[model samples]
Target: MAARRASHAGSWYSDEAKHLGKQLDNWLSAADLCHGPARAIIAPHAGYQYCGACSGFAYRQISPVVVRRVFILGPSHHVRLSGCALSTFTKYRTPLYDLRIDAQVYRELEATGHFEWMNMSVDEDEHSIEMHLPFIARVMENFKDSFTIVPVLVGSLTPDKEGLYGRIFSRYLADPQNLFIISSDFCHWGHRFRYTYYDRSWGEIYQSIRNLDKMGMDIIETLNPSGFTDYLKKYGNTICGRHPIGVLLQTVHSLQKSGNNGHKVSLKFLKYAQSSQCCSLSDSSVSYAAAALTFE
Candidate 1:
């Protein structure tokens, strides 16, 4: 069965591939105001019930051109790796299907100074990356050619280092047939999030996250590396894959500067809703949101 594991089935998303695909399909079908086919995106990887709609927005904008590969740079939710972790798993089990990892690509990056193999904690039962499977599957169901994937879980990337990496990886990333995905979610507000008593709709939670997201989005729009880090630090943002976003921004800017930034590179606000907004009338609160990025 090509070494595989059902890390988040039945919990983070669903155990039935069809059902999961339907859920994502429903969200994408109704999305509007999205832009071109993007090579990369910053998506939230939380339980489907919460952020699925928001994440769907990003998936909805993807137009699989000649993409032969997908690189999901996820966050470290359950396990931690030295620099970044590259999974040796030949197949990553999801409800829709067990997608194969491009082993040779993994090795190629490993050969490069930018990549490294992870130890025991490289990948555990984490939904940060897995939650996105059905999404990609739904989008690429019609892809004519086989697709490859490289899952990179990044913890922290310094501002200066991110810039250097951007410069170094520009040419490496200029290839038009690859897609980059940054797995992340916005601010984790309140007690439910260990930030405070997120269980209750306290004073003003939306205000806080929106205030923070504004800063984060600005950095993305401006393609500013330092601005990204400064904003993240100032608010002590809880974006799980902050470092991954740093790498992505650097990588995106590198491509733009090199004159190969693609046809339609853009950031779109797909979905945004706090957990409190969705909690049952009788229940308390939670933080949740979804957004998508696309390139044409």
Candidate 2:
């Protein structure tokens, strides 16, 4: 079976297994597991130096032993896809280990008639989904062979389409054995990004950016997809993975509508950081946030 190589490794992150493992271990150890045994997580997908440590707060919540399948939903940065796509490869090669894709789940999703297949070139070129493989491999290392992955490359979906896909995946979200990882990075600020929303009332430019992101994060914690949509429409925050995050919100909303076994579900933001504080309009920086969704 063909495997997707860790093409971004050695540059985006370390290629050496020992060094990468140690880095993940240190970050995971530093993060406090406050809202864990996560049913799902929303974490950043930037390079390790930029968002890796911040992402640990999300991964640290996983009860790896209980999870048998991981569903990774990430945005498409390089490709212009109108709908969601699934991986064609059987395995994904990370520095630590190769993660097997769940063929059974792929078959089921394909049967839905709503998914598309991504060829090897498109799969290898996208970094949003690839960035999370090493972390998943490390967190589930002990039971690595016991679990399989489902990687979904979400496209520029309309809110209606997001709900459609959400309803399609709601069953898996209800399964305690499944875990969802939503890859996203919040707010790209600066002239280079062509977005410089500044409110002097927030004191500084970076503070304004923080306030803007916090507003969006708060909406996500409410588990209201429309609310998130409204926030995005209003501020136009440069959240690269807004489509994937919308799908996750819609999934939770669908589960709630179905009563979801009467279980209470809550999503909380655990960590937030910026690559650099944007002090001027000419400066550029990307925001990273880590959140966990728990079912109680």
Residue-level lDDT of model 2, residues 85-173, one tens digit each, is 99999999999999999999999999999999998899999999999999999999999889999999999999999999999999999
The list of candidate 1 runs beyond 4 A from truth reads 119-122, 167-169, 192-203, 257-265, 277-296
TM-score of each: 0.85, 0.99
Model 2: lDDT equals 0.95
> Which 10-residue window of candidate 2 scores lowest in summed lDDT?
255-264
Score candidate 1 by TM-score against the native. Answer: 0.85
Q: Which one is best on TM-score? A: 2
lDDT of 1: 0.68
Please give the range of 10 consecutive residues that has the lowest summed lDDT in model 1. Answer: 196-205
Cα lDDT tens digits, model 1, 1-296, are 44557677787777887788788888888876356466666678877888787777777667676677888878777655445667767877667766778887777767767766554344656667777777877787777238867777675666766665566556645676777777877776555555432223333545545656666776766667678788776767677777877887787787788887655566655556666542333333444444445555
lDDT of each: 0.68, 0.95
